[model samples]
Target: MKKKKAALLIALVMSTCTAIAQQKTPKAVMDQFMDKRFGMFIHFGPVTQRGTEIGWSRNDQVAQADYDSLYHEFNPRLFNADVWVKTAKDAGMKYLVITAKHHDGFCLWPTAYSDYNVANSPFKRDIVGELAEACKKQDVTFCIYFTVLDWHDPDYPIHNPHDTTQSKGLGGNMTAFKTRMKNELREVITKYKPFMLWFDGYWEKPWTTADGKEIYQFIKSVDANVIVNNRLGKVNDKLDGDAVGDFLTPEQTIGKLNMNEPWESCITICNQWAWKPNDPMKSLKQCLQTLVTSASGNGNLLFNVGPAMDGHIEGRQVKRLQEMGAWLKLYGESIYGTQGGPYVPNETYGATRKGNKVYLHIFQRKDGTLSIPALANVKITKAYFMNGGAVIIKTDKDNYKIELPATLPDENCSVIVLELNKDAVNIPVIPVKA
Candidate 1:
């Protein structure tokens, strides 16, 4: 009897621990994350001085020696964390993710683990710390972008652009390198308390599946509520990973419609990840359409903006973000706290849903008429434009024909609200016809 009791107690304790671990990312936390459909991704580092790509340009476009030494002369006198956070707020971004450490092994903070950080540079201010504080003041969630591979670290196996002779397969102590990475990660978590950690550079050969799992578990151990992306392990072309993480990340493209798991699309406002002079910027129409499609596909959009060397986002980029904010102001209810719709996104239109209402976002139309496949069990009781205009909807056995007005409220994307008798989300997802 005593032995049975002891075994039972041990089993109960183990079960309790498992439950605790599962509850780390509570439903409320995930709901909040999903609700924040839009965020800002800033890729700012010493590479901004050269107006080239952040990490990839180390040896290809610019000489490795010149690229690495740029930090020594780095001094962004105009950098104001408050201004940066405010810019994001004005652009209707609910969260912010900044590069704490890029693949080039340059640290944005005064990390005790490495001397290759902002502290050693001419600008000694803690960029990460200041941004965290600024995010708090602005009521925005602060997140960190950290790379798994480091070119400058002696312990890491790979030294590609920096040393041409030394390949990734070269001899190095991965154990020591992992230990240093853990220490730096712990420091960043403790000091900044970021809500999310956007990891990159996991595609490198040196980083393995075991490493991804360990790092993910370690991060959870530090802060159970923190969110991590799928890039922690080996991922496919779509950026879907096999290891553990809170969400999937589709870089440079919008993710496909997937209600089974959480995802976020990371795309840049300009052509390059880092700031470049005379870079062509995306128009307001393109920006809003991207946001609409991502949300309609049941995903978030992490739009990126590379700040200039002078510590200011290019004037045109800022203006484009302001335009996005303006559009959100008028029709935010169609986006915020809403789920992707029964109508799948297509070239012409997409949809989002909240409770009994489905928002149809029409990007293009032919002769002011749009056709959408009808939901099997759902009935549209009333239909109207989001901005105070009546819309005519004719429902057939197969589809619904919406007659749009001659003049749209917004040319980029016009939202139409459909009041359903039942909850819109319960309806089966239907595809749009060509």
Candidate 2:
């Protein structure tokens, strides 16, 4: 009996030690990603100004051959890497992720893989190189976006043999394809080391099964600390791969991340990935709220902006992004270095908390006070405009109310801070799924 008792005590001690270690474990890398609430997603290549999608000139009513050949003719005389970096910084973006190579197989920098990059083009300068250097100089985290599937590579497999333009990662020699893909991947990793690697087009035909795993392992061998998205390839089960990169990145939309692990939502300012002469961009208010809403749900937003052919951002897009930066500058306390609330508000509002402070973001502000009826225990101490630094709050017994101000500091949304001594004790989050 004594021996058994000793064994039990030892087991308890080990368990306690393990629990303490787990709690004390520092999530540094993950924390850095979360702290940087905003980043710039660039989708610019030789195909811009041609008025066609960068990679899909073949069947998408775009000049496939001419679009592909634009790399040789590529020369952004007005291209200013510093200006781009400055714009992103001014817009509250802590990081910038650019497309080193899109699905069209046109390389932005000189690569030994093929003669289809900037080296062969009229633009003798290396755009990605300049951008990487600029980002480092400006204290911005740099990331690269590479298309796993290429449409223009001659060896690339295509179902329709007669259609030269439609061959987009359709049918290629698996062995040769893997080698060439790895070569480009190595070039990107070696030439310009990045904080994140956002991979796209893995869902195509041959990138699945063992081929996908092979590429995944190949990537890890080079940069194990690099973050990768779950969209590595298509699997029968969940979006699974060799787990080459860190983080799961979602494109186009935002909502409650249904994945078990960490995830992010990357959306665009306009409809197309490449900059169009006239494209409807998301409004200032929409961009601002979208960011906060995404953060509130424990996910990051990689906002995209496609630059014009002359290397200039659309004024409309720039204006809105700058506005977003100004708004973040004011209410950034609730965003940067913050974690997702255990209970998120539904339609009208959402919740994000850091340490002792819980930020009450009013997406849809009511007249006098926003009623947080569900938050029975939360005593409202102060409410203020995030952009202008003005306190606005009202309380009455157990029923605390939000006293709104007449003028809105931000044209978009309002950030309200609810000061409380303690957290909402055992509060049930009522997500309006309507």
Candidate 3:
């Protein structure tokens, strides 16, 4: 009886330790990921040939038979991994996430478990492998985007975005599906050595909390250092909690000022996630502000760009990214390695800080002046424009005003540096009028 009790205690202790291990990521790894602040999200596949959205277009916009067979002619002869990685690097991106497998169940790399992979396609080259090598050569971190829901696989329960006749989580071999998923993920982790796994398509009823926990633990067992996003379980559009992953991923929008947790916003450069001819792209001003706002809110930005069928990024999009790189070259000090504000961000301006210096990012001004709530305990010792000019500062009892020049240095976002008397990070988050 005593032996049985001792065994039960040992089992409980081991289970508790495992749970704790799976829940937390290494601080060093988390810090490194957050410090990057910017990355490239590549959403490319056979769907690029049809000029439709990847995965979701199957059985909706395009016939399932036709969409599934597009891989036969998926020959991206111009797809150069070097060019892709270089494009990201030139755009001041520190990392890259390519879609290894989307909801269509099409795999970019040759996987033993799936016949619907790059090996069978006319291109016949390992897209993920090449990208991984290219990222390494360019000194950029390589990551993978794997979706949890496979619409193409017989084992996976969900299918047909437009088909209401068939219900999810019915008539599918979930056990076999999970085994295949584990096998493919194991291959991805051991072979590619990705720094992170960006998961999606987990909100469907087919995937559950238990499944998410299992997959999360499985990935950690393979590589404890690799980071996972919040989509490993059921999460709302805002990416609020109750999930098993390393960080929060707020898709297509900037996350709120959240200094307590790590988050990254995935937004597209264009309207579409996959390439389309003559697609409208965001202007340089819009792009720069998106990045700046993300940084000002204490979050990272994973800006997406979809390569065309010919495996080249759109020239116009590339030019816009280059413009952003030029701006970052001048004012990157305000964004990189800095934590979000002593003062909470508002419509007119936002703030970021590192050490004793506070960077005030003025997105707009009224009558050549920007006003924000006054800091309670910190004193501004010196103030200057990040570009190359002096700034006039006037402080009242409740608020402070920064008088701007007639012609701002940067039309996209003008940055002002404020040297504080104490460590800016030590100051509590101060709310300002919107």
The prediction achieving the highest TM-score against the true structure is 3
lDDT of 1 by residue, 1-434 (tens): 99999999999999987665444466678789989999999999999999999988887788879988999999988899999999999988999999999999999999999999999989999999999999999999999999989988988888665565665347778899989999999999989999899999987667887888788877888888888888877763343335557788888899888787888999999999989999988989899999999999999999999999989988899999999999999888988888886777878888999999999998876677787787777778899989777789988668898898887778899899999899887877775455
> On lDDT, who's better, 2 or 3?
3
Please write out the lDDT profile of model 2 over residues 1-434, one tens digit for every residue.
Answer: 99999999999999975554323113477668767878999998888858676676544666565566677667878888999999999999999999988888788888898888888888778889999999999999988888777767767675332365654534457678679989988888878997777778776665664665566667766765566555555542243344434566767877573324456778999988888878888887778778887777777889999999888888888888888888877788887766666446455666677765677777765575665543555544555555446565455554446666665444466666656666532344444444
* Ranked candidates, highest lDDT first: 3, 1, 2
For each candidate in turn, give its C-alpha RMSD to the true structure in angstroms.
2.5, 7.4, 1.9
The residue-level lDDT of candidate 3 at 101 comes to 97
Screening candidate 1 with a backbone cut-off below 3 angstroms (N, C-alpha, C), the clashing residue pairs are none
Q: Which candidate achieves the best lDDT against the true structure?
A: 3
- RMSD versus native structure for model 1: 2.5
Give the per-residue lDDT of model 3 (tens digit) for 213-290.
Answer: 888888888888899998888864333456678788888899889888889999999999999888888998889888
Q: Which ten residues in a row have the lowest lDDT in candidate 1?
A: 235-244
